[model samples]
Target: MYKETLSSGIIIVPMQQEHAEQLEALQRIVFPNLAEEELLHADQYKKHVELFPEGQFVALDGDKVIAATSSIRYHFNLNDNEHHTFFEIMGGGWFTTHEPNGEWLYGMDVSVHPDYRSKGIARALYRARQYTCKQLGLKGQMTVGMLNGYAAVSDQMNIDEYYKKVKNHELFDPTVSVQEKVGFEIVGLMKDYLNDPTCGNAGAVIVLDAGKAI
Candidate 1:
């Protein structure tokens, strides 16, 4: 497992391939609506293991992986409508080639073992992502789901408006909240993004400017 201490001197590290199953199980418990096919697939874990093993930071209370968080970076391609004057004034950009290497981090899969909850483990893992982003020279971070988003078919063929009624829909996952607390901001919403029956509503998209990294 990869490991390090935070500015507050807490130990944290990366989850190993061996811990992938546990992480998936934990994520399912926390985010039951997430599609099993997409979120818990073995290949998905393998990709993370290969591409972001170190980005998948875990907290160890001994030899066990107690909590975990990971990130994936890719180019964001912004559509024309997003180029409005107000959007640019507010720095509304992600789907574009502007970022050096055309990169943005998809922060995902944060989970804390029951015994480790309330111990600030999530905060540490989040700090680790920020640290990695800074070290890699990334420009920003993004996440899915915020408001009025509902699950639709893979192609968003049909969607339900019930998403506006889902409780806690605006609340960020622990990882997302950490990103926001450190200056990440909500950029846009992905309507009917995920069609999986498991995920309650479509996901929201959030962004954190690289300049805000601590």
Candidate 2:
């Protein structure tokens, strides 16, 4: 299992069956408004560990799961900007679409507890994801970033304007901004991507090139 201790004193480790309940609770806290169908449960987490143990990770504070991320391997064509819903991509949150020999690592979920925000947990988990990508010789990491901050200013602007503002640094998004700061690059905008009213069901397709030093 992959393991590391961050300077912040948080430990990053591979996900296991024992972590499912904590992870499920963390998910609810991190994404309170996430679509019902897209929410994950303990059984799905166990299924993920059974399917791809190395691709799943959790950040711990003395055995407490403060953050977690789940990923699945897939053959991703960088040029393909086709739209896909969160449920479809995540295989109903069970990561049932994993491809053992796929070309890229697709991130299904990333969650950091509210109390642990800005303490480097998310970045650490992201680094762990990159480590797994390099270890598996995958091309890179890919994910649809949530526009978590959009809800606050949603009444003032449409998603397109909000996206442009976020991209230009005129605004900061809890998800997209953090992902960009940690090395992911926006490739395209995904509309109607999930049942997130806060983000107008929008998502940003982000990619990290593991072929390069990340």
Candidate 3:
């Protein structure tokens, strides 16, 4: 009833009743400082609940789920095409934007337990998710990432300086090269939009496309 695959000597599959605790623990460690509304807690499991049947995947060593990725399906209508579904967003859960529901999957909220870092678990999990998306006939996937606030301004708006004043750090700079290695395209930026108060400013929004796969 569930999809199964093996990676790096570990078993990867769709999460089931046995993985509730492991998933909860993973969320706590990966998302600790955010508020209730800002945070994605176990209570919100319903948002991703049904996806387990069609959109969730996990990487496990023995009985331990070390890495995970959740898939989201968004429906969108292409501007040029005649009411056709073209955009789908997916990622490791670090970000979420418009819901582009179509023949596509949005990869969201990816995490690797600290103890198991740098072990290729994440890469394996990502591939499995991609495989699932393709199997379901999704043409591609989309994702967004946090970036610096300086370049988020438009000449008409002239809000670049305000962006810097809001966020004091450049930690989320999307200009970095690492994000490129994973097949993403920089699309847009949101300035002082998040209002994190703590992080000081809003973050950048990058779009990644996973080209057609067979």
Of candidate 3, the 10-residue stretch with the lowest lDDT total is: 81-90
Estimate candidate 3's RMSD in Å.
Answer: 7.5
Best by TM-score: 2
TM-score-sorted candidate list, best first? 2, 1, 3
Q: Write the per-residue lDDT of candidate 1 for residues 1-214, one digit (tens) a residue.
A: 3467645445797666777666666666665654444354434555566655545677766666567776666566434113222122112212121223437666654667766667667767666777777778876665553232233322543333333223234433433344456565645545445544434444445666766634
For candidate 1, give the lDDT of residue 51: 56
- For candidate 3, write residues 1-214 as lDDT tens digits: 3444554577777766566568767867764643434444453344465444467677788898777777667653333212211121222222243243556565555677888766666656666666766667766654433333334443323444443433343234433223444554444444443324332333333344455221
State which candidate, 1 or 2, has the greater TM-score.
2
**Measured by TM-score, how close is model 3 to the native structure?**
0.63
Question: Measured by TM-score, how close is model 2 to the native structure?
Answer: 0.95
Expressed as tens digits, the lDDT of each residue in 82-126 for candidate 2 is 778999888988787899998899998888898989888888888
Best by lDDT: 2
Q: Alpha carbon lDDT of residue 200, candidate 2? A: 80
RMSD of 1: 8.4
